[model samples]
Target: MSLSLVLLFLNFFTPQFNEAGQAKLEKMVKDRDALTAQWKASESQKSGIFGNRTKKDMIETNEWLERIIKKDNLIMDELRMIGDIETITATQTGDDYKAIAFKQEKDVQALKRAVAERDKQLKEKLSERRTFEWISLILFLISLGLGFVVYKKVIKP
Candidate 1:
């Protein structure tokens, strides 16, 4: 029964891991598409600015540059969100695809933060499990010793 319970828990965790990973991957892809679109729009505006350079053209180019900056900021923000989601998801599943997704989500700096957070959380969980195992072992040994003493005093020959 204990084995079955542990297996069931493992099975339960598997889907959550996969689901989290898939959702993050999809979001990353969406951000990539958004970045591409923003890049194309910025390029078009840049071409327009270069085509005609006058006072009016300077004002238009300034507006175009502002739009480009806004688009760049949007891409940066989406990349950040995608990084966070991928990091959280990767910690759940040791899938290499998660690393790919992280790369697709953002640049190396973002990936570093994601990896660090994932590793930190994993270390904390492992530490907790180790502590729990030690505590359980101590309790089990004390209980066994107490039972042995009771048996010798009350029921032994």
Candidate 2:
């Protein structure tokens, strides 16, 4: 019965582990890596600015800063996405637990109901047995009394 219940529970509420989001995470990682490489290349180009810092060099540096800021934003977005996924997974797990708990509660209630019915039946049977015993005792006493009266009346006279 327990095994059947477990199987029924599993069959009813199978968890869906989402692997599709993994591909998106991998793509985000690649994008971050590519951005890091671009930032590093931009840093290496700073050697030209150090020799004769011109407006062009400053503008180039500004562009590099912008790229870095863009990368940071992308990283932040990725982190948010990961956070969202974690929250979703946690919520799903919590919901599953609640469902299991509810099912268990239902099972307990059903068992309680069955036990109450059985107890009621047992009490009824006991009452019936007691009634029959009393009837039997009364009949026996009446028969004994009648035999005694017959013996007294017949044998004495």
lDDT per residue (tens digit) for residues 20-119 in model 2: 4556656766876776676666555544545755566567767877876786787677668767866775776677778878999999999999999999
TM-score to true structure, per model: 0.33, 0.71
**Model 2 misplaced stretches (Cα beyond 4 Å):** 1-50
What lDDT score belongs to each candidate, Candidate 1 first? 0.68, 0.73
- N/CA/C clash count, model 2: 0
Q: How far is candidate 2 from the true structure (C-alpha RMSD, Å)?
A: 5.0
Candidate 2: what lDDT? 0.73
After superposition, candidate 1 runs with Cα above 4 Å error: 1-106
Best by TM-score: 2
